[model samples]
Target: MPRFEELDVWKKAARLSADLYKSMAELKDFGFRDQITRAGLSIPSNIAEGYERATDKEIANFLNYAKGSAGELRTQIYIGMDIGYIEHETGKCWLIQAEEISKMLHGLIKSVRSRTS
Candidate 1:
């Protein structure tokens, strides 16, 4: 398998995390900002961590974690948009990107699991 760094899913996830941090850099709410950013960061981190593992099952577990984190980040984006921290257009884009990342992770998880099964 290619390294996680070479995976488009990982690259997109890392980009999403960076964009989220940039957009939230000036938010007045520390709690919300930190929580969302952490969730955003977790997606790519989990992907890389999973790829470093020795077994397919372990890799799949980490990919699942990344996918879950993507869902969490999408929820936060919705809340942020509703609360006026995020503009509707930006939030919409982020939602779409997050969904794409989640789907990508799901595919990776299934592929890895199949190797084990």
Candidate 2:
């Protein structure tokens, strides 16, 4: 396996985290902002952490963590939109991106699991 930075899913996750920080920069609610940003950051963070682990099984576990974070972030995006913290279109885009990332994570996990099995 190549470096985590070399992975497409990791790159996309990093971009999403950066975009989330930029988009939420102006929001006054610290709790929500922190929660969402942490969730966003978790996606790539977990991927990198997993890649650094000793075995494919460990990596797959971390990939699952990343996928869970993606789902958590998606839920927060919806709540943010409903509460007017995010615009409808912007929320939709973020949701779509999160979903895509989750799918990618799932694929990666499956690939790793197959090899380990």
Q: Give all candidate RMSDs, comma-separated.
A: 0.5, 0.5
Any idea how many clashes model 2 has? 0
Candidate 1 TM-score to native: 0.99
Tens-digit lDDT string for candidate 1 (64-103): 9999999999999999999999999999999999999999
lDDT of 1 at 33: 98
| lDDT by residue (tens digit), candidate 2, 3-116 | 999999999999999999999999999999999999999999999999999999999999999999999999999999999999999999999999999999999999999998
How does each model score on TM-score? 0.99, 0.98
Clashing pairs in 1: none
- Each candidate's lDDT (Cα)? 0.96, 0.97
